[model samples]
Target: MKERKIPEPKPLFIERMNRLIPDTNDQKNYWKIVKTEPVNTIRVNTMKINSEELIKKLEDYKWKLIQPWKNYPEILIVEGKTPSEREREILINKNLAKLEPGELGRTLEHLLGYYYIQELSSMLPIMALNPKENEIFLDLCASPGSKTTQAGNVMKNTGTIIANEVSLGRMRILASNLERCGITNTIITRKDGRSFCRKIKEQKIYFDKILVDAPCSGEGTLRSSPKTFLMWNPKTIKALSRLQKELLKSAFMTLKIGGEIVYSTCTHAPEENEGVINFILNEFKDKIEILDFELPLKTRPGLTQWEGKEYDSRVKKTKRVYPQDNNTEGFFLAKFRRLG
Candidate 1:
């Protein structure tokens, strides 16, 4: 048996990105930065433990931990490799500990849900949403439950959260993570996000804040999931953009007047980012306004022009984080508030 080799990005995909980002030195730096692996990052589950205690525990293992974001001490970039076999054997022999997988998740802390392993940029959408206590919230495409869990944490289990996933297989994982994180404030639902939002809106259930983390081609996640390149297709991008626009549309309709909605995706495709936002801006016109938010990491404004197609100037309020921008996965986030 032979190990399969990973595939590289399609030439068309690379060409598209080059044109989209079209700066000579930036293109060089982007290529260089994206080739390297992202450092392991974990967000300490504050529902279970304090950041200081978790930092102390991990540092005892000689892990050099760095919290890269301001005022967010729970986000830790773990440096140094996991314990080697020799070191594990010594600990097991001396402390009567059992042999275990030498990975970050194999620790007692993780097993107890003291922290969650998530990509750095993956955390941005929740931050952009700025979840609050006692607010009705919905994670439109919640699965694997990272953002859902973060939203629950921010609300401190005070609000009702609807965590919806279309896939039965993914729902199980979402449920498990929610339970693992001890989040009791969420209601898990299985339905297509667009239909689910519509169904709830029909019942007169309006959310105070909503997060439509629309699915996309995942072009920005090449650093974490290189297989994304193999799955990348121009046709797929177009299909996803359609679904994204619908999802955002449904979420906006379900949001109460003066409520906020955040649209985010883990792809650099302008079709999925500014394009989708543009659709909503036109669809709702004066009823929706883009809200600008700042981040602690490096990010660029959303493009106003792509391939000579112009988007609403307000789309520039959207934020784009490239892999090289924060040494994290590529991500796009835009915030909106419903107006009467």
Candidate 2:
């Protein structure tokens, strides 16, 4: 009998990660965690449900939920185990299957938008942004509206949120999520994110805060979407990085002098993360300031050097959340403020 072989990312991907993370043991752990499944975490929609009431309703189903933060009861880490074969033998004979871990999304609570099944790391961009009531916000490159809905929750549907996406199909999904989550303050827009920002800048309009959750090579999504291993390409990363830089430039232009912008991505590619931030910092010079912030999860600071390229020193304030460090998808987050 032949032994089963495990799958891994492309050599180029491995090589790049090795370069980014030089520690031999750390690299091994990184790859090991990347191949594992992420934990189930959901964000409670305060607009529609109280965290305690929702927890009471969910616990009746025998699901174990842990609220990682006392202050953030909205974030729930779900954990539950199915009965063993012997324990479930009677139910099996009775033709009934017990609910399992993946069934959270189909629950009544989910359909009612009482909560959103989002990755813990994916929710951090909004947490860091700390959206306030009655403030103008923009989610550039928003699709499927996860962060948009989260922002809507934080703002209690008071402020206006411009959720922009270029693709019509994705825009539809974004609209659906926003509607399902009872997010009334968001306006869906169909346009290239950079061009839309530039146009809005021409109108002399500015946002209080913006989120550029840029699309990238998606190497960080390996656990959820293994196909990213094959889809990873150096050329694609370069192209995406260029587009990200332009989007940041346009977003920066449309930001008020005291406005903040959170740039994030679900990719470990330095060129798309720190490299993009570096490009914007240099182009804008003193006009942009990288902000230092904190999160509930463990995070590493942004890389200052990769592939012989050096980024601005201020980029050290950027946060990098790896799959190994946290039981979630890999994510890069950088918060910025417009100074000039």
Candidate 3:
């Protein structure tokens, strides 16, 4: 028997990223992180168990739990590699928790819905939205339900959240995660997020807040999904940006006057981040405005000029999180408020 070797990601991916990232040191750091392993982190589902209680349970099981340095108190950084199959079985046999096969997901705690295995960066946009209890919310690109269930926890499962996804296959996963997380406030919808406005206007429905976790090239997630290195191209960024713009327009149209929308993506492409936001700012100058919010981790401001084209100055308020900054996946986030 032979041990399979992990293949090295293509250099072309890093070279292209270097050209796109403005800072020399940042570009170097980005490549460095992508080659390394992604962090093992998970969010404690407060809906099912509070952090203190969950921490006690995991600690009793001999698992080391540390809080992530970021402001999200509900999240805990797990130390130590995933246990072996025999060890996992022993833990389960002891009736401590249902032990799964992986580090975060296949755990007794996870099976009971005590925690959600999610990336650190994936939780940021929901933090920015700050969805409130009793308010109406929309997750425009929700699937696999990480953000959707996170929103439910934030709202204490008190508000109505429309979780929409265009793909039926993904919608099934989204529905399953929501059910597993014990999220009852969400109403799942199968519709193209780009046409959300037309679909919901018949009821004169509007949301108090929205989240557009737009689909992108997955550049930031190379550490976990190495195939992104082989598959990413400028054309992917361009096509996703066009779709993102339409989705943003739909989200804005369905949002109440005072409602806020948090736009985010896991890729480092400016075309999908600042470029799309800038284009919308120009087209809906009077209808929307960018809102600044803070994250505890270090982040870069959105680019003003990319490839000789200038973006709206307000786009500077937008944030870009890099793996080097926090040992997490790179992400772009911008908050916008409907003015009209």
Candidate 4:
């Protein structure tokens, strides 16, 4: 397949970003326009039903199940028209008049807390984390509980999860989603993730696994919220990069020796993706090892070969999912294990 051409940076955007990251190349392209198809996905509550039984039930209803993710058995990919159209079609076809606005809201399974409406690609990083039963997990910047809920489902509601979000508004949304999904193993904390780490410092409350799904400039989410581009500027990216590095450092500190941390972002910017990871690796050299992970779907690793700047060799283990390749949001995920 030919490489999908990334969109060039707009002059206004370049001017703004250059002010923030002065040496930023005028030809640098971080945003890409690709056709995004909305996928209505659900994770079968393994606490409620097994994958086979869930598949059988959906098949009986004539709903075609796409391939199952390798690590997450209860999670299934379902095809439909994009976004609102797909939800409308499902309601009309199934005669689900009372269904709510979100994906899978009207489905009997969703009402019964059998599944959740998550973007298929969004589920990748959490799946890669592979939360195990009885393990203590921390979602440093978790909000709206997408990945947090996925971790809960993976543990089958057995372990404890610290779902921390800085904003009270997004925390409420996260709490509601967890409740709807019947997730009870999480403690919702409304605190800046970095401060939370410091507060718990002496408690020795290190996590078995920590997920640093840090905040980005929303460059990758432009397709979902195109209006974001209206405010897109390099200054925003630089500021977000600094914030990401700090959050990641705190996440690293909270990780138990020999534990793993999964760093991910929705943006395609190297400054936020590999650049942040490289900073952590350098600060904690000889104390962390990158893990290799591959998805069954087609994707690429970080563009380490970009420009003359060399990325850490460990970047090869990181995964990059493109909007054009996956028909989902552009994302980057890297798994790292602390060496004791």
Candidate 3 has its poorest 10 consecutive residues by lDDT at 92-101
Which candidate has the top score in TM-score? Answer: 2
- TM-scores for all predictions: 0.92, 0.93, 0.90, 0.80
Candidate 1 local Cα displacement, residue 327, angstroms:
1.1
lDDT of 2 by residue, 1-340 (tens): 1112246678888888998788999888887777666677889989999999999888877667889877788999875534556657765433233446469888899999899989888999999999899999999999979999999999999979999999999999999899899988888889999889878988888999999999888988887778888888899999999999999898889998999999999999999999999999889999988899889989999999988888888889999988887778999999999999
User: lDDT of each model, Cα atoms only?
Assistant: 0.87, 0.87, 0.85, 0.75
Off by over 4 Å in 1: 1-6, 81-102
Q: Give the clashing pairs for model 3.
A: 98-108, 100-106
Off by over 4 Å in 2: 1-6, 82-102
Q: Number of clashes in every candidate structure?
A: 0, 0, 2, 1
- lDDT at 68 for candidate 4? 61
TM-score of 3: 0.90
